[model samples]
Target: MKNQEIAKILYEIADLLEIEGVEFKPRAYRKAAQNIESLSVDIEELYKKGQLEKIPGVGKSIAEKIKEYLETGKVRKLEELREKIPVDIESLSAVEGLGPKMIKVLYEKLGVKNLDDLERVAKQRRIRRLKGFGEKLEKKILEGIEIARQRQHRFLLGFVLPEANAIMEELKPYVEKISLAGSIRRRKETIGDVDILAVSSQPEKVMDIFTSMKRVEKVLAKGITKSSVRLHGGIQVDLRIVGKESFGSALQYFTGSKEHNIEVRKIAIKLGYKLNEYGLFKGFERIAGRDEKEVYKALGMQWIPPELRENRGEVEAALNKSLPKIVEYDEVKGDLQMHTKWSDGANTIEEMVIEAKKLGHKFIAITDHVGSLKIAGGMDEEKVMEQAKEIEKLRERFDDIYIFHGIEANIMKDGSLDVSNSLLKQVDVVLASVHSAFRMEEKDDSPRNKSDRK
Candidate 1:
């Protein structure tokens, strides 16, 4: 709810701080913002309880800022930062692979301040002449800008999921049965819109409540059986009410990959049946409609998981009764790659471990950044050893879960790791990642690149 709004402002503050070359405060703000975004409870409720500081990563200053926002609906510090920077920093940051440091460089070097300015510079080939940027990187920036432009109206699945769930919770009281459908139900990484289907005896009442939702920015249409509204974030949501008899059919039809539906339709026709949103029929007698399983069974196949309904051999697998079993969310035991306060993460080792234990984890790895990635407050050999000893001591206090001491080491441009092999051998796990040189797309077939690629 307000968590996202607060997090966004704090992120902007972080960006401005970075642009102005303020170091530690930006990290602090970013950490606090990240923790706030992941919070399960309402931030306002935490403020009312005077427990804002208790949230991991939030300190006294940040807590006061949160209180200020809840009270005045704005953070004064962010407003002041915006005034000084005088750029639409958020839009510029949305381009892939463009970090705050680079943004600052672009501003200082070419007076580029926004997406349009960056695009103009790239087109003029001026960006390639800048230090640390070449033709390849400049081209990539142009592509990234275009992609960001295309995705402006869409939202990430992770970002939109909580809001969609909240909306579903609100509508539960009014509908007989409701299900979320569309790309969201299919769990696509980015969603253009949300589709919700419900079964209700009083369709008109359902439509009324859907249109009148507090978060509804505008009602596009309202009808007896269907309604459409735009949410606060420009996300379009469509709600459809269907009879109980057609609920399953409606769900199947709406929760579709167009290709998947075509294949299923072809199968139905081969079996002497006609399928539609209302029902699967054999010469006018309804064979399956009330239950999704019935529809699949009638076509001599097992019901497919929504995620696999992409016409990617799923239909064939279902027909052969050889569909692979997908892992349930609960089956995941632990996270191997996560940060704690030892590096750039907001939470402390104990706090992170405690949260993981609460989630029923059997084990987890504390993979803080190591070596030359100074932006993440990377640890050196001495600090890594110190952290390992601390983790060992912490292990004695908790027997419910196993903790692995690990480091996320940076891979240097020359194909060497930032951390020494001797130090890496001492840890339970090592995660090597590329933090720079994101623009060079062609594999460096040079001997150095070849060895590194290996």
Candidate 2:
């Protein structure tokens, strides 16, 4: 889908505009980018149908920008912003403590344009000399640069999943067996490359189809057993065709987090077996080469799920047969915390309810900000009563899902809730949160507090 591609450019535009100190438009661009990014359907399809404005936060101006991008593959305004500011916003933003304002300062004062430039400036002790920037922040920027370097080219799992699935669907018919392997199989939050393991006697044919796919930007290497290609979006896809006997073992080895496989190999050694990509071996005889279950069974352990194969005590748990069942994504039936347009959220209460219903949620809470947190447009007691009336009407309209009229009361400096008891009793739930003064010293729980409670 062009959704991610378009969303990325729009997000860049937002950052670029923000760097230029443009008001309101940056936020508008960002919100539009967010709405487009979350869309399940193609942005191109919406553009074709001229329904881009139907997307929340997308007005005619931003919708026109999206259309311009789709039709021309570039936005003129974004290009102009890029030429003016010329800062690598994404890389700099990846720094935990850095923001657009700081980036603007660094660019204006230190000529910091990218992570590398930021690091150089931080190391040279130039940032600390500037107003509002300290030695500590400079040190933090250096550390952040290291982190950004590590995360440089990794794609979000959500972005790469569709492409990987599409490839599998295309190549499934050409192989005896096939499964996603590597970090993709383990479902890492960020992925470096796509790895697919398949068993096929006709490896040549499989490799041909895999490398020749429409998404392939360049064929890095192509062989009978293995092939690697760079996708148009810069993600690498590696296809490997192994023997049917070694498919499971290959799958297990390839789906490793390195540390997980290392521990599993140690278990194999302890049990007088050798484990590798080919199979689990016993004195050179293949003991478990057919399936993952048998391979783990041979190791005297339960088979580990791909997600849990991160070497985080999973091996021990599997060996002890004490692996806890992890909750699947679809197992969630309700979302307890949410905000509507009544507060800072982009969507309305009814819109949230409709989306939640589509996602199979049995219940949802509309926990809008309330009380003295005016920064978030927090509702007062009177406004809460008004929202309650609206929710009651909604609850009647949507009978399938339970709607909870909730309030996110701010926790004041003294650690007491900003909401009143009378108002609290009126809502289904009270989500008391620290909305301000995050770095304040914690108040001691002295006997005085207990005495006040008494």
Q: How many clashes does each candidate structure show, in the order listed?
A: 0, 0
By lDDT, the best candidate is 2
| Candidate 2 global TM-score | 0.85
Q: Note each model's CA RMSD in angstroms.
A: 4.1, 3.8
Superposition-based RMSD of candidate 2 using all C-alpha atoms, in angstroms: 3.8
What does the lDDT come to for candidate 1? 0.88
> Which 10-residue span in candidate 2 carries the lowest summed lDDT?
439-448
User: What lDDT does each candidate get?
Assistant: 0.88, 0.89
lDDT of 1 by residue, 1-454 (tens): 6788788788889889998999799989988888898887888899999999998779999999999987886788988987777777877888987988888889889989889999999999999999998998898899899887776767899988788898889889888899988889998888989999999888888888889987787999999888999885568999999888888888889989889899999999999999898999999998898877888898999999999999999999999999999988788899899898899877789998898998889899999999999889899999999999989988999988999999999986666788888998999999999997665656653455565463
**After aligning candidate 1 to the native by TM-score, how far in Å is the CA of 99 from where it should be?**
6.6
Whole-model lDDT, model 2: 0.89
Q: Tens-digit lDDT track for model 2 on 1-454?
A: 6787778888999888887788988888887887888787888898889899999888888888888977787889988988999988888899978999999999999898998888788888999999999998888888888888788789999999998999999998988899999999999999999999999878899999999997787999999888999987679999998888898899999999899999999999999999999999989899997798889999999999999999999999998999999888678898999998898776789999999998889999999999787867899999999999999999999999999989999887666788889998999988989877765544644335645653
Pairs clashing in candidate 1? none
